[model samples]
Target: MNIWNLNLRHLRALTSIARLGSISAAAEAINLTQPAITQALAKLEIQLGQLLFERHANGMTATPAALLLAPRIERALAHIASQRVTMAQLRALIMLADHGSYATASTATALAQPSLHRAIGDLSVALKRELVDRRGKGIMLTDQGRRIVRTFRLARAELEAGLTELASLQGVETGRITVGAMPLARARLLPSAVSAFYRAYPDVRINIVEGSFQELIEPLRDGELDLMIGALRDPSPGADVLQQPLFADRPVVLGRVGHPLSLTSVTISDLALYPWTVPAPGAPLRVQWEKMFTDADVQLPNVPIECGSVITIRQILLESDFLTLLSPDQVAVELEAGWLTKIADTPEGLRRTIGITTRHGWRPTGMQNAFIQLLGEVAL
Candidate 1:
């Protein structure tokens, strides 16, 4: 009666019943008898301690619990479809996805053509969808099949991570950490922290994903990223994400080493004299940049380029006299390398909180927690 002992057949039965809205229809979909479908539903309800459907004269109506549980069931199925799907099957699908042909997949996996097709057939059943379709001599994944493949890959990664965690607990050398890096952190804090982390855990793999706030936040919420390091947004970015402040960061004017403005003490008016590169509209940095100008009673200078790319900005600054406003940490390396020079700190003392943003209710694994501790040490 344990829910954990629930089998794929029972879950599929429930899914079919909920979708088709009848025990008879569900039975036909899975090729089981109506009475068998009813028995499966009854057993599932007992184990779940809730009614999944209300039996009616015409058909079965899904209960609220069934409605709520459907998506979770789909996600769970996507993660670990069934014991029926072996590694060989996943390997076949992966090869087929890449080569776009069963014959090619057979050659790559060293599996026979029939064996590969059979494995895919079993996988399609476990996923309750047609995964492959033949167009002349070629084969391709259905839309649902493609989605299943993506979700399955993520699930496989999670499973691998679990195994790696166990190995680490047993004193084995292995682990991986995925980090989402935003502009401010990428330039200094992240690199320093990563360097320190590597010295301690060289066996652990590190992946740094760089993107703007909007690009990274969704993935963090979806559990694709362990944590994000960057300029913390004001007003608490979202209720689902929690931000921790490590230090205060303020905007500084930066220009190439020999730019005219870098040679002299500059005021707000002097800044207005040059064309500039600034963050795109609606970005947090853009808001700060505009405020700095307005506070100085200086008309905003002409911006020939609006950008968020650190690489592009650095390149443009190196080649031209166009100035830019950026967090000091963001351009720390360039300044130290003598490729860029700071004009001055924002006179109004504008500041942004620099820190980590993680999904709410997320608990970091041991090594991940250790890495976060290292980030805190470096931040201080």
Candidate 2:
């Protein structure tokens, strides 16, 4: 409770144990040895006068004390993470306000580093103590620094929003547009959209990032990515956003050369029995695969392999009997090369939709509009 004497390493160790389930796992999470983790936990318990976890055969089980503390610990971490966004936003605001573009401060004062040093110096002087402990890699955030960052991000977002709104709207769609997408789409959807957009209006600068669908939701709400595109299975449209129906896309079953299925006119049932390579659960293709076998009255055999990339899946399928399911669009090359053969009568209803989405009040730039149109053309 005493911020002056609190040890962040100990707090981090306790958080790791709560998350990773054991002292050993916690050590792995924090890059420390098991004994170091054990020592940190012991030190924390001594400071707090409470046991946070119960050692168990299965794993470390959270005590009531730990369970109550978990949410607080996670909130603290979230606060720390927000500092990164805050710092970035603060720097961006300074550049936008002064030079019109991010490159204006290119000469110096990048990413708010100078501002941070000034703030730290001011604080150290005010407190009559040295706060920043700079190391070989980077300066570690003192507890006070962490607290400052947590609050700072909220204030920064508000300030940035106002600055963005007032800073003389350039092209159109005056607010931020954050997009979330998968890796394959990096080559497919992103570049096309960016090009189609810039061609129409050169001023619509977008902040685009790539990640899995699961990782995109929080950012969407945090006002990061404006929209998300990627194949998601069994998408439960949440109350705040509407998930419009996109087109059902085509999926093909793939097998390596010399697979028994390759020689056989593999039935859906036959395809289900072999060792399979598959997309991770929740991928659009994986969902289609599960639905296909079930629709044909077949139970899915154990899939021993997981592949996230279409190219990797194709190579594995061609080299061995590893049956992989892929979107036909993604595997046109493999099918043509004879490296992969369709093992089953590629089922219906396993197609992904190419669609555009926006938040309820989301505005689109000319570029965003042009790109969405182009996506429709390519997808259709």
Candidate 3:
């Protein structure tokens, strides 16, 4: 087997697709667009000289060829993960050689200058790969260095998890647990638990990336972030994802106080008659909303704007009769401020369980585990 033939991106993309089942699901899992994922898959298929998937009604499923290759791919992935730590060491060496005692920066930086250089040098020599060479620009990664960094990201994450695990066992706290979550959760759910976790483990760092549910899933699945919390939908059943329902969130229809429908005593049919800024199609809430309308013998109107942004929905509400359906958590500010009020006291068929997701068999680091535990503790 031309072991050098398999690159990290190829293996990861394949694994993601095999796990999730569709290119679209894999894209969501890894946070790439459908086009980018398709291209990656195409390239990997070409490199491997075999079709990896069979397109299906729900999504794609791995082919027998893919199944046969799984074990070898996994083994290679494991080796790449080990090589990555070594690669980090080499890159660190190169970085230090160039930056030279960058002690000029504040002491609290995540990676110090000296440690970076030594790590890089050690990695390069250990790999027997001249990842960098001194040139007029001081130093540059050789052709191999570029490839290593390009494809080794996931493996690097594995390396990091291993290192973090070891340090935790030694009772030497590592750093922050990074979480990728939608803006509403960041605002409402994370603050309290994160604050408490920080107080108890002062040395553990905490980081957050805020986006819509669609935006956060890829980061979480790719191991870039520890976990994500949002409306629990089955992870694109085809994308190899594992989800756990953490809490239930009520569905809400929202409008400014002055909106025409704000106090109209609207029935489900009344909702379908109005212009709406709906959540994008395929999302669980949107699907549920459509089903509710369909059940009431109404077709969900043509959505002029379909988005996942509560802020934008709120802005649309302020200017026009355009209305929105949101998770209760999302409209907390506007609701409390009296800018938006409910059309009804209760929204039937609008509530859903919020779920947390991670890679199927993926485990969390100590910090990640701490944050997730805290999130569950402070759930509404």
Instruction: Give candidate 3 regions above 4 Å deviation.
Output: 1-151, 235-239, 345-347
lDDT of 3: 0.66
**Poorest lDDT segment (10 consecutive residues) of candidate 2:** 162-171
55-135 in candidate 3: lDDT tens per residue? 788888887667655544554376355424443453343333334333422133357666665666667666678776677
Candidate 2 residue lDDT tens string, 17-100: 888888887887778898887887888777655677898887798776666555554544444443122233334333333343
Against the true structure, whose lDDT is highest? 1
Alpha-carbon shift of residue 61 in model 3 (angstroms): 45
Steric clash pairs (candidate 1): none
- Give each model's whole-structure lDDT: 0.78, 0.59, 0.66
Q: What is candidate 1's TM-score against the reference?
A: 0.63
Which candidate would rank higher by TM-score, 1 or 2? 1
Ranking by lDDT: 1, 3, 2
Candidate 1 at 67: error in angstroms? 31
TM-score, every prediction: 0.63, 0.54, 0.62
Best by TM-score: 1
Sort order, TM-score high to low: 1, 3, 2
